[model samples]
Target: MTDQALPRVVDQATWQHELDALRVREKAATRELDAIAAQRRRLPMVALPDYTLTGADGPVRLVDLFDDRQQLITYHHMWFPDAEWQCGGCTSFTAQFTRLEFLAPYDARFVVVTQGPIGEALAYKEKVGNKMDWYSTADSPFGADMGAGPGEGFAVNVFLRDGDTVHRTWHTDGRGTEQLTHTFALVDLLPYGRQEEWQDSPPGWPKTSTYSKWPGSEDVAAAYGPQGVSA
Candidate 1:
């Protein structure tokens, strides 16, 4: 590596001083995020229709998606009908969540809802080795209602269950979903960040087109193996 590609060397004390200053801002940002979450919790919710989604076991009501839990978080995976491969961003994002049993103790459950048909959705899920329970909204208005309609983009939704009734408490899409992925988080810790063109990086740092280096479906499948993708 060239010297221009690396951070300038400094004495230990100087390095510690810079890091301490950054830590103050980092802690402040953390507190701001916590405050935002607190505000999110107080936001009102809207009631939802009892939409039916197709699962491995066949038609299942949206209310049942919670699996008896009071709260549910669903990732609306993007789909390209009849295509050989699917959205790599969606695949990679959803793949990070391998085990969500931890949410069970918090009285919540996480699942995936896609615009593809049940059979094809399950097949793709298996091919990528995802472990999260997946359902299809192909036959229902659920995907459209959730802002992930056919040919559209991906989304993350939050819901609350009251007996047989359900309410949508939160929804986010686009870059807002970045917080759910560790890949970006870890990469951002590096000197070059994601290497995406849009990132603000020092001169001489390597950069590429946005998402040009993101793993594709084939890459994910190869890494995880058939029926081995953790999430």
Candidate 2:
């Protein structure tokens, strides 16, 4: 970290008093989020028609992604046509899907779906975490219909499967998936926010464009951290 302008140093009592005020607002915001979630759960669901999606295991039905589970949460991963790489923002977001075994006990399945070829999707996992479950939507409109072709960006689709019926419960776009990154939340808590140009950092604080510092080569990972979680 470099020397930069910092929030004014304060006395212990003054710090506590300031923290107390923020805590009240934080509590209220948290409750509001909880209420929002309840409403999200109650939102109407849209049925998905039978469609094909390719995985490392070859062509498979969309329902197969559910893995005999009643619920499936898929990250609508973005891919480039060049077949050499993936979107950095998508990489940063999908990295959190690792170690999500906790979803299994609850009968939920998580997957990353891409419109690129299966080979590219598979190569993505190899460059990143080989353990990640990545799929290719191929020529199928399954991804576009479910909200992938819109902005050439990404989304998170929540689904509920009952017998042969597949229902889309909730879906969130790129910005909506921001909460998946615990690291970003941690960064927000710091005096300097993300140190990225897109963020409104104070003068003298480090800043870079959100898309800057991307890995120059497809094989190399971006500098999200030493652990390979690309920002």
Candidate 3:
């Protein structure tokens, strides 16, 4: 590592003082996030049509995705037909989530919905070693209606089940989905902070093109093998 990349060395007292100052801002940011979540909870929802999505076992209704749970969270995975691989960002983002049994206590179920065919989607999921339940919206308007139409992009959506009725509660895309992944959160704690050009890191710290460090589809494919699970 270059000398310029290192943080300035200081006495223990000075280090603690600087850290304490930073902690104050961090705490404030945490509270601000809580406030924003409160607002999200208060946001109104829209009732959705009875769109049917394709699962491994034939057709399934939108409300069926809840799996008897009151709430549901779905990751709208991006798909490129006839492409050798899928979106690297979407692949890496979705890979971070393995076991989601924790959501059961909250009365919620998490799954993936893609714009690809069910057979292809399931094959990709197997190749990537993803364990989450996946469904395809290729024949339905579900993807377009949920802002994840063909070539549009990836997104995270939330829904509420009221008896047989389903309502769209919330949706987010871009960096908004970062909160769902621990990879970015842990990387942000490093000195380089993703080492991306967009980050406001200390001068002289190593930097590269935005998301340049994210693993590619081939890398993921090789790591997991044709049918191997992620290590």
Candidate 4:
């Protein structure tokens, strides 16, 4: 049978109703995952050590970036100064960094660290109108120490600090544009949300629309506007 003429396993109404039900199930699953995360937050904490990174005013220590806070979430953008262009994926990720203030109440500070020179990093941040603090790991070996250096793989690593000690808490390296969705981790517990996009759909069910092809190249920045291309 041709693709469009496949056997009708279920009628349209039944299929849509099932899709709606699946969406509800996915939302329930996400809620459970969030509750588990809340429990994880109450786990025992560890002290963090002080580490310094280069900033506009010269070397600014890690403790200073924390601003006396107990936790820090660094973006660790992949900005090899000499590269022809910044990492397109990293560029997309930084574009979403506009909502940095929303993360403050979580008792953590967010900052971006790049391997580019102070001038280049500052220029990119200015171009994008970034609200978060930006730093350059060019001078010190901080990027290498943090596993954010070129070829070591990319990830979002969360660290905890108390007094003068720092400890790694969590990290995630989602693939593709999906990786650009760290903020989505906080999506609400609604039936028609996330993971639901891929849930079961009966025969003849229409596919969900998307912004771009999955894991599209860095060149798809036109739709992302200046936010994605600024860097």
lDDT (0 to 1) per candidate? 0.91, 0.77, 0.90, 0.65
Per-residue lDDT over 34-149 for candidate 1, one digit per residue giving the tens place of the 0 to 100 score: 99999999999999989999999999999989989999999999999899889999888887788898998899999999999999999999888777999999999999999999
Off by over 4 Å in 1: 1-4, 227-231
lDDT of 4 by residue, 78-138 (tens): 7754664566666656666666676668778878888788888877666544556788877
User: What is the alpha-carbon lDDT for the whole of candidate 1?
Assistant: 0.91
User: Residue 162 in model 4: shift from native, Å?
Assistant: 1.0
TM-score of each: 0.96, 0.87, 0.96, 0.67
Question: Residue-pair clashes per candidate, as listed?
Answer: 3, 1, 0, 7
Which stretches of candidate 4 lie above 4 Å from their native place? 1-16, 35-49, 176-231
lDDT value, residue 84 of candidate 4: 49
lDDT at 44, model 3 = 99
User: For each candidate, C-alpha RMSD in Å?
Assistant: 1.6, 3.5, 1.5, 6.0
**Candidate 1 collision pairs:** 129-229, 130-231, 131-231
Clashes, model 4: 7
Q: RMSD of candidate 3 to the true fold?
A: 1.5
